[model samples]
Target: MASDMLLQHLDYLLALAAERHFGRAAARCHVSQPTLSVAIRRLEKDLGIVIVQRGHRFEGFTEEGRRVVTWAQRIIAERDDMLADLERMRGRLTVTARLGAIPTAVPASPFISGEFLRRNPAASVRIEALSSREIARQLADFEIDAGLTYLDDEAPPGTRSVVLYREQYVLVAPAANHLMNAPEVAWSDAAGLELCVLMTTMRNRRILDANMAAEGVQYRPVVEAASVDALYAHLSHSGRATIASTAWLPQLGVPAGFAARPMVQHGPRPVIGLVVPDRAPASIVAAALAEVADDVDLEAHIAAAWDAAGDRRG
Candidate 1:
């Protein structure tokens, strides 16, 4: 019986239910009132039930009509689901991806991901926080679709990467700390001072250690923190200096007594890059995301953020 009815006309019934009036319903359906009414009547006849109870004005639907409305909703939902499934099966799949990055790398994502979505509306994206090593491992394992991390001199094998930004360590200390008065502080200049830093497990911490060792400087933190928040909290009140990426300073919200200054080191700047494993061809979504990353304004974005922070400090 259902096979005999025009499936295209089910829209008219939905429109009628929404408008509850013949003129508006037909107008919404983009058909003449008589055309829509005739279609609904035809549907009722095919189903062998009274779908709508007519009156001087428009009255409500009969019990069977209400049931038909419920059925229409289920049918529409199922139809859309099937269409999405079919698209995936046909290699036009809509992919959902998770990406992780260090706190500093977070800003680059919106610009890149925004343009990606504009180009590929069918793709879905998610962003999360992860350390450089974690980013590398996740990409290698295919657990995350992509990652942004410091691209050490040795690039990971079986992966492709595009250098996104370079990072230099900086000193963030309370203004009361004498080092702030200097235009630039050398790694050795921090030797005698108390320090707070993320634990040794983080790549950032390792870089800090290398810089200190290169300068033959040694210091210990009176307090330890796992995250940027804790690092800054200790920085704000501990009267000690913390070393971190200059990229992270903008979001740290340094209090009145704190200021960040770049470190003077002869070592190479750490290059942060967007990485994807090269083992397989990128899906349409991942390809679109990679294209977006290629077009990002890394220098300008970082310069602007730093400039804005400088303005706030002034």
Candidate 2:
């Protein structure tokens, strides 16, 4: 009876648990609906306990099923780690780097991952744009091997974080805006301007708010958006302004007809870095990333890239 169990069955069960619908779970596993349901039922029999709460439609998991789902996640994660370790020992390692990053750090991903890819030529990459808090949670849960986020104020406890660069803030607006001519902009002065701001839930937005508050100002934006692109759209079309970090300028660039002026703030400047789980499992990609980070002059390289992009786009 024990021989009846298979990793594929567990995979099906996990898919079902996540999707919560037989048809959708089957699609996720690239199998037919009946095939998925049958596999899940097989999992229940092998475990000798009812895993799912069956109903006319797709119902949630049973009590035992929830526990099994937790084990399944751990089992899958350990399997990947074991495979990665074996590949490393054989000196023919090929793996994918799974990374989670805060929104502001997304722009700098290419710079960090590019160097790692050069060393591990066969490796692939996947990056999710998440909040700083979510990045820490994913890293802790073993969902993501690494995270890129703000390191100074709220770095996750018991994690190894290496600072890549210190981020400086600026006020970005269309050249046609009145503030564009100034060598520097004050936060109090910006509070009165039409602005497109990041959602308040984002840590980057909170940091921006704190910086503005330090200068005796409160920035009440005319618009709010989840993505930097959306904020840029509003700022560009409506002659509004947005705050950006110098690190992000490398990827976003100063668009034609726009200028980025340094913000004069006596507030805290955030240090951005790469964060990995404390004593993470035997994952080669995460270790390789740490190794690559140690060898590069990341700060100078990103500064040059940001400047080059500005020159081209400005």
Candidate 3:
């Protein structure tokens, strides 16, 4: 039994196990099911055990098949690691950034990119749009080089952060809504209002949730939207109201009948920022980028948010 030959069939076996259908696995491997079946049979013969149990409905893998799949995954992982090392040696730096924002800061990312490219021209960057929890998980797995997310709350372990901006939370409603006439309304006045909000998955939504809970205000949002477009769609036809960051308002292009104002006893606004792993000895580009982004006019952004909020009230 040549172990090398068995190793060659490992990929086929794993694919078959994953797809759980012979024809699909063969298609994935670019081979005929008969060819893959023969190869797997040869591998099983060499190992002196049955690996797969055949059936009309693509029945399950044998116990030994599960073990083989585990080994195959480890083998593939090592292969990926080896390829990454080779790519690194060839001077192809692959860094992924998972960024999460309140739909407002999506535009702000390009500003960081200009500076990032200036510093690391040799590196290739991949950007992922993620929610805050997704950003944190990707950072923990070393899947992302850095993330842009809210920095007001306690950060997850093994990460460092720098505030990039502060965003003012404002009340948004159809221009016809009653709150439009008032300069401001307190959180205590928020109850019994039909609201429209970004889905609870967003960090921005969570911040509002906490504030409302603290004020003993209970809101039942008649509309829930996951993105800016969805929020706008609902706001156009109905009297639904929502909270939005001031930076995001001008970009939303709200219809003529829509209005926005700052809340009295304003809720806590999130500090937008970048976060990176606090691992030992950061990459040269990573270290330099963090230093530069941190030194930017972050405090000025905070002041701007406050000033904008004040003007809206006045």
Candidate 4:
């Protein structure tokens, strides 16, 4: 019974860690702030250490608090794993898996989710558009079950990736824009155009910046947004152009009076893929998602789109 009480308190601690505010964490846990505070204090007394720093408000976690949070995560994960294993054995693995994807990969999510659901009829998916760095951090913290993001040169520890498609860029501009009719646009040429781009924090923006720098092209963007949808919204109202992956164009639908031209003078194509944590005993849902990812023919679809876009230019 004492162990059960400790487990309950651990849940409250993890919620506090995530929310970083006592009131918010209490709300998340469906308890009053004072109740949550008492639970945490009881946990500290049981553990013989202080976990959270107190002040007028929630200051932060102590060093010991951080370590306890890590252990709490592992303990909770193990409990879920046991439950999942039991459900799998009973042939009733019903779990909602959370997938974190970079904003640029949002267009591909429907296909991925559709296929995964088709294979695992009992399982549902929740996809969130996150930055690449956030995806990595979430994966490390077990906040997300899987991630769809660029397969960077260095994979994060405890994670494995499988390439799904090669991401190629294109320039999107209004039909009246001079470069819209061009078969291919060079990085240097794009640098001269008034542009709206992803914020510098995004990996896609960094890649675009590096490609332009390689060609000795330097220019400032007229607008910056965190998501591709915001970029599109800005482009819809102005004559300014934006860079986006070729594979995402079909989903974005060339807006009325807008055209997309393949970017020819860029650096190497970046590979975007599904990344899952490599737990010793993977969750049944993660295993199912990986199996579905292996069967998805994303590359073929991307290639077909690329060829069709080129044919349109001819």
Candidate maximizing TM-score: 4
Model 4's lDDT to the true fold?
0.83
Model 1 weakest 10-residue run by lDDT: 279-288
* RMSD per model, one decimal: 14.8, 2.8, 6.2, 1.9
- State TM-scores per candidate: 0.63, 0.87, 0.62, 0.93
Clashes of each: 1, 0, 1, 0
Q: Rate residue 120 of model 2 by lDDT.
A: 73
- Output the lDDT of residue 26, model 4: 98
RMSD of 3: 6.2
> Which residue pairs collide, candidate 4?
none
The Cα local distance difference test for each model comes to 0.71, 0.79, 0.66, 0.83
Q: Which digits, one per residue and each the tens of the lDDT, describe model 1 over residues 1-314?
A: 56645565677887888789999999998889999999999889888999999988679899999998777754543444455456656756466656777655664667667776665577677988777777776655445667777778545566778777788676777766667777778888876678877777766777778888888877676766656667676665567877766556545545566777768876788888877767433433445556667887666677666676663332
Regions more than 4 Å wrong, model 2: 1-4, 305-314
In candidate 3, what are the lDDT values of residues 109-219, reduced to their tens digit?
Answer: 655655666655765555666777777775664446577777755455678878787776667766666676787766656545667787888877777777788877777
108-194 per-residue lDDT for model 2 (tens digits): 888778988887777778998888888877776667888988887588776897778888888887776777677688888878888
Residue 16, model 2: Cα distance from true site in angstroms: 2.9
Query: Rank by lDDT, descending?
Result: 4, 2, 1, 3
lDDT of 2: 0.79
- Could you tell me which residue pairs clash in candidate 3? 175-257
- lDDT string, candidate 4, 1-314, tens digits: 36869888989998999999999999999999999999999999888899999999999999999999999988877777788788878877677889998889988877788898776678788999988889988888878888888897644567888788888888888777778677788889998888989889888898999989888889899999988888888887678888888767656756666777878755568989889999888866777777878888988876666666553332
